[model samples]
Target: MDVVVGRVAKAHGIRGELAVDVRTDSPEARFALGSVLAAKLRDGTSRDLTVAAARYHSGRLLVRFEEVLTRDVAELLRGTLLLGSTDALPPTDDPDEFYDHQLEGLAAELADGTRIGTVKEIVHGPGGELLVLVREDGSEALVPFVRQIVPTVDVAGGRVVVDPPEGLLDAD
Candidate 1:
């Protein structure tokens, strides 16, 4: 699995620098200096870029790629999606923590082992993250990704045990 770490927001300076809107929780680890990254374009094109420099200005991240040396070249990557392979991703220090990519596609089941659906996506919002499950009926169920509701995430087992309140799944 390849996770989206950031996106090229806009060209920053004439020196080929660009501003990136970070999507990962650990920017320092994901966007490490001198690290090479994979960029995916909208037209199904892929490119490898090396991080020439990375820094935080104000709140957002400012990055410079070795391949992008001019504003025009940087402008061409404005909407490019930055990706990081899970194979190279180091495990988190916290045992219970899991990345979004890891949670995706896991089977969602009730506490009694009754299967509900497969987790399709994880949506972030003001409250928190919601697990989007594609049910067998071709419908979708939004299950909150909180620890209380989702008590167990067995990544190796390829399943998540959800203890949702009554009517939440039926209503969906």
Candidate 2:
């Protein structure tokens, strides 16, 4: 149930602080001071780190881990993924909103109940987040994660209803 909440952007300062590119919508809660996080490094190793300090600088999140006490160590953490469990995160107050973890693996069907595929992963990009759908033929489709495109998300029922517009599902 470990979900990636952030990625190490780069070393912030000489004092082991790290600039983080937050992936989760709730960065304040996910990267709070004194919060412990589990991480998987690029080399396939794992470590548990405690958030020694966290601050915002010009709207960017800066964090310092107690274990990473030097700028060199922090620099090595670039591209590292910070993990948090879903149970520890605050519940979503907006009923229409759903976390990325909740959408992964859900069956995606059309409005007329056509079984298109299942959600493989969520791709976060500059434009917005997209739902990666894998079909039975093993082809993939990137569906925009918007209310107009993805109207319904039934997490409890394990299904997502998509309303794709013309040419949306076409392969380019």
Candidate 3:
């Protein structure tokens, strides 16, 4: 399966260029020209495309895909998600570390096995990143992404043991 890296925000001009909201810091490495992309359309349909050109402009990624030569067609591709297959991805080469994909479905727990919630989202915050915990009432808690706060992650067990700061869990 391909991991999502960015979303096509809108068409740049009448040149088939698309403005992308990037989710990865290494945009140049990932969205370079001639690279292949497995994109998910707005309707949840997926397709394979080849990147013809790409450049950074005004903090947005301007990209052109092969066969997407018209602004109208590019407009229609708005809100599409660009992804890369896991098999094509280079190894992380990090031990005792986890990627966002590994953290997605892990259950949030306390030291004593007290369940807090489920990992719903991993959002990049101003200070760092935050782990969103979805509760039964549809409410959620934004747990700080820190080693001390989130000490353990058991992907096989499908849970994460968190040691939240004082009043952090109570706020939710």
Candidate 4:
């Protein structure tokens, strides 16, 4: 279960540093020094890369890979997805906390137990996280991943109880 930790946004400098668009919540652990990440390139090839160094610059994550020593080589890595295994991640201890993978694919249902849709993915934005749902009608719905609307998450049961407000699920 390889999860995307980040994507190479662009080459940051002449020293092969890459500006990365982080996807994971635990970027510190995922992009730690000496960490090995699988870089899935846009062309469908994958390569193992060792983290030489990582830093934050102007609110963006900058990373240098041991294999990428030139700016040209780093530029080639643009849009490459950096993957980390789920096996390396520890389970969350907080009852309210869950990894995005855990919520994705879960059945979404109303409080009354009427199934409405399936969770497509979790979108992390500057405002907040949103649950992208594939509704029964094949339309998509964005539900704010907040406690007020999503009251129950049964990971073992493979379902989530949604208490969406009026028109929240209505198709546009």
Which stretch of 10 consecutive residues in model 4 shows the poorest summed lDDT?
A: 120-129
Q: Pick the lDDT winner.
A: 4
Superior candidate under TM-score, 1 versus 3: 3
lDDT of 2 by residue, 14-65 (tens): 9999998777867778888888899889999999999988998976789999
Candidate 2 lDDT score at position 78: 94
Candidate number achieving the greatest TM-score relative to the actual structure: 4
Report the CA-based lDDT of candidate 4 relative to the real structure: 0.92
- Which regions of candidate 1 deviate over 4 angstroms? 57-59, 123-128, 137-142, 166-172
Clashing pairs in 3: none
Task: Go through the candidates in order and give each one's C-alpha lDDT.
Answer: 0.87, 0.89, 0.81, 0.92
Clashing pairs in 2: none
Candidate 3, residue 20: the lDDT equals 88
Which should have the higher TM-score, number 1 or number 2? 2
Give the clash count for each candidate.
0, 0, 0, 0
Better of 1 and 4 by lDDT: 4
Worst 10 residues of 1 by lDDT: 120-129
Candidate 1 at 114: error in angstroms? 3.2
Q: Where does the lowest 10-residue lDDT sum fall in candidate 3? A: 88-97
Off by over 4 Å in 2: 56-60, 123-128
Error of 3 at 7 (Å): 1.4
Per-model TM against the reference = 0.78, 0.85, 0.81, 0.91
lDDT of 2 at 8: 92
TM-score for candidate 3, residues paired by index: 0.81
The lDDT of model 2 is 0.89
lDDT of 4 by residue, 77-158 (tens): 9999999998988889999999877888999999989999999988778888899999999999999999999999999999
